[model samples]
Target chain A: MPYRPFDGQNCSIAGALAIIGERWSLLVMREVLLGRRRFQEIKRNTGIASNILADRLQTLVDHGVLERRRYSDQPEAYEYVPTRRGLDVNPVLIALMQWGDRHLAANGPPRVPVHTVCGHDAEPRLVCSHCSQPIKAEELRVRPGPGANEAQRAEPLLPAD
Target chain B: MPYRPFDGQNCSIAGALAIIGERWSLLVMREVLLGRRRFQEIKRNTGIASNILADRLQTLVDHGVLERRRYSDQPEAYEYVPTRRGLDVNPVLIALMQWGDRHLAANGPPRVPVHTVCGHDAEPRLVCSHCSQPIKAEELRVRPGPGANEAQRAEPLLPAD
Candidate 1:
């Protein structure tokens, strides 16, 4: 498939999607984040074709999300490790997992996130940084910021309440 | 392209992706979330082909993420509105936006989320529900839950520290 870029949108979500929006990219990230870094281990977990996985991993490395490091000298084996940027994808994964757990999971969540700091199952919540209050979709709106173009700066993006 | 289902993964993230993992799906959700529900408006903003947009919207409606309603009588204009399931996608979008803002945005964030409740610019942060402390990717681990399959139950998914 030809690469279709979202560069014209001038929106950050679009920007991020342009990088990680492929169907298998996040699943590959999931494997690495779960500590399955070797080529075979990620392949075993995701059932993704080896060629596709190699392409995705190369893209991730090019994007600075994952760093490839030699792990074995004799076999010339390497492990893919998450850089800071890759680790930052945790929230996105957790948000998706929670959404699935609520609407799709029939039995229960297959995996639970445990916060090592609090020593309990982590139900991650999105909160406002300024007020430290939980944010709800209805209670949020968007305003043009420093990067806004003329059309965006002219009006708030969301509907008036 | 044939529909690829992630059902065999037994993972909630994969389940969620199976629904919205299409390249254009989340961008469509972004349009509706930002109050651009009209077909022309969405097409203008996202540069998505009309047929593709129609298909993505229908898929979202079929999945109960969006509710399509007639908004005009003479021309038979319709609009897409977010259902509870769709509204729940806000977190994923926000997480993606923040990631893009931090990594891709050269100037700054094009759109800034504002918390209507606190009347402040909302920098959304993911925090543990129990401890209410911010979550860093390194400080979290995953364990098998009630929905875990036999393989998942056999061991922890993430590496041990």
Candidate 2:
């Protein structure tokens, strides 16, 4: 499929989606983040065709989310490792997993995130960085920021409902 | 493109992606979550084709993420409203937005999320719900949960790196 870039949107979500929004792209990142860094391992876990996986990995590398490093000298083998930008995607992955566990998982979540700090199963929650209060969808509002273009600024900023 | 369902993965992330993993689906959700409920408004903002927008909205409604309600009587105008499931997608959207703001936004965040509770520009962070410590990608681990099948359980759970 041809990639569609959200060039004019001027929204950060759209900007991020332009990079990692594809279905397979995020799944590939899931594998890398889970420590399955080799080509075959990610391919095995995702069941993605080799060509497609290669393409996704290249795009991720081009975007600086993952980096390739030689792991085996004799075989010329390389491993894909997450950069800081890639590791930052953890929250998005966790958010999606929690959503699935709540709505789609009939039996239960097949995988659970463990917070090594407190030694317990981690239920990650989105909280305000300044106030430390849990963020609710209705309580959040949007406004034009420094990066907002003229078109974006003209749009209604407050929650309409 | 044909939608490829990640059957047999038995992973919540994959399950979630099977629904909203499509590139346009999440963008559509971003629009709805931002209070752009009407068809024309969404189309205008996302620049998505009308047919594709219609298809995505129908899929979201079918999945219980959104509902159609009559907003006008004479012209039979209707609006899309987020259900609980839809509202739950806010975190994912916020996470994506923050990622873009950090990495892609050249100027700054095009839009800022305001925490209504504290009346400050909200920088949402994912923290352990139990300990309230901020989550770091390197400090987290995954394990097979109650819903894990034998295959998932057999895969190495620890972070290899």
Candidate 3:
């Protein structure tokens, strides 16, 4: 029912999904990042079946997103912590939250990120890597790159600006 | 098996999984935005099972991320296009790609996102809302907002910034 192969679509989007695209993998990352470190804590917060949770955690560890470390020698408990790889998923989670808050939300955002450095609401903005300008949704366009396919190279792929 | 509910840890992240957190939903959005409009094209690009693809497509349409339109009257062919809500997901995909490229890539990224405006490898940076400065990962934190629960408000929940 899960772990379906992503199409080797010769694209990074598909490439990323191929790694983390499981049933509860991203949610597991969410829980761990949100300070739900223990197995039972994560399971209780997510209502995920124990088998599925264990499986997802194992896969994430195998892929280097999480590190499995024992907390206590007496009780022999384990906690899931984000490696650099896992911590990098914050932007992805922010993106998802912004999208859900925009559409599916009935009230308002359930939680808001604070940019501790700037001391303000950390509204994730898409800033251009080169120009360092904040990219509004209308300010983007897609052009073929070196990795572009035949059709892509011939005709540029522009989604919504 | 499929519709697992995340109980409530950081409900924003949990709630995020409630929508785009499914297996193929984000990939489906990727294909649609990347100019794969037809059913067969999306299925081919995603490698998702037909039934699962159809179900995801239906859910996306129901949620208004995508709109289905008849492209031809003869055979009545349809195409999927991202609404504003759907295009909003590009940052999420880009962020995931950045993550996968950084940690998971064995040699190099399978593909890269080019900022068409500047024509360089575009790493979409998250900036602070108040000032337009880049928000570094380690320099961000969060506090309870108008939406914080009693438990969330009772304690200081500082996730890794």
Candidate 4:
């Protein structure tokens, strides 16, 4: 399968961006996640042009992020719903939202994520799954993993000074 | 003070995307975050053209995500470093990397984040700060916050049925 030019870096960040890194792509996902499923609804909410929206929708569906289902037959309307893969983007969206809320929002966070199970204003915290302790950005380092290519493996340890 | 068209929507995810949503923008950040500080080094690592790299670097500096500093007076060489604001993007990059590793990687993750303090491989898990329990995408919902626009305020509480 052909990959984006940048995907040659053997980096997962680049690999992910090759799929949903476009501004409009994630915005489309936001709409569906927020309950706007119809084409017109997504188009209006995103203010994205019809042709572009159509293309993005097709690509998303092709990539298994969204599933197009027939919602009505009279005029043959359809709704796009997130698949498990699409739902997996929640963390990325939350991270982006939290960053914007912290740095961009003048008044406050525009929307806050609530943990429905716990019933409290929930801010997502990244924790070490093994230790269950909060993980700070400066306190983490990257190392070559099983999939690392030869060049990637040869790179120096991260946070090089 | 100019903002993206979607900024008016008052959504933090959209707000953040307005800043770093472009494919190349985040990729450029990844390179810098991984210690590729020089212009030529970033360009080579990201495979981005010189013009595009220059444009991204300028934008990142303009937005306060990166700072440009002179490294050599004789040669007029400079290095780009991530500002505090830019370093805050670690969670976003980690989220993207994790997603790509889980769903897109053919072998396994090329790089793994290790918690420096714990000395163990760290997979960031989203936890509810209030409860300190891991939260999954299916377990979260969004609600209007102080910054919500009137229109957003009026929208049915999120995850609306």
Top-scoring candidate (lDDT)? 1
lDDT by residue (B11-92, candidate 1, tens digit) is 9999999887777999998888888999999999899889989999999999999999999999999999999899888888
Model 3 agreement with the true structure over A1-161: per-residue lDDT tens digits: 24447544556666667667554787787777777888998887678889988888998898888999998888889888888777777777777777766765565666778877767787768888888877765445556655556655776666542
lDDT of 4 by residue, A62-159 (tens): 99989999999999999999888888888889999988998999999878898888899998899997788898877777889999999889985687
Ten residues in sequence with the least summed lDDT for candidate 2 chain A: A1-10
- Higher-TM-score candidate of 1 and 4: 1
Give residue A59's lDDT in candidate 3 (0 to 100). 84
> Each prediction's DockQ?
0.76, 0.77, 0.52, 0.76
List, in the given order, the native-contact fraction of each candidate. Answer: 0.87, 0.85, 0.55, 0.88
Residue-level lDDT for B14 in candidate 1: 95
How many angstroms is residue B58 displaced in model 2 relative to the true structure, after the best TM-score fit?
A: 0.8
- How do the residues B1-161 of candidate 4 rate in per-residue lDDT, one tens digit apiece? 12457757778888888888778889988887888899998888888889978988898899999999998998889999888788888899998998899889999999999888888998889999999888988777888899888888887556542
Question: What docking grade does candidate 2 earn?
Answer: medium
In angstroms, the error of model 3 at A8 is 3.0
The better-scoring model by DockQ among 3 and 4 is 4
RMSD of each: 1.5, 1.6, 2.8, 2.3
Order the candidate numbers by lDDT, best to worst: 1, 2, 4, 3
- For residue A62, model 3's alpha carbon misses the true position, in angstroms, by 0.5
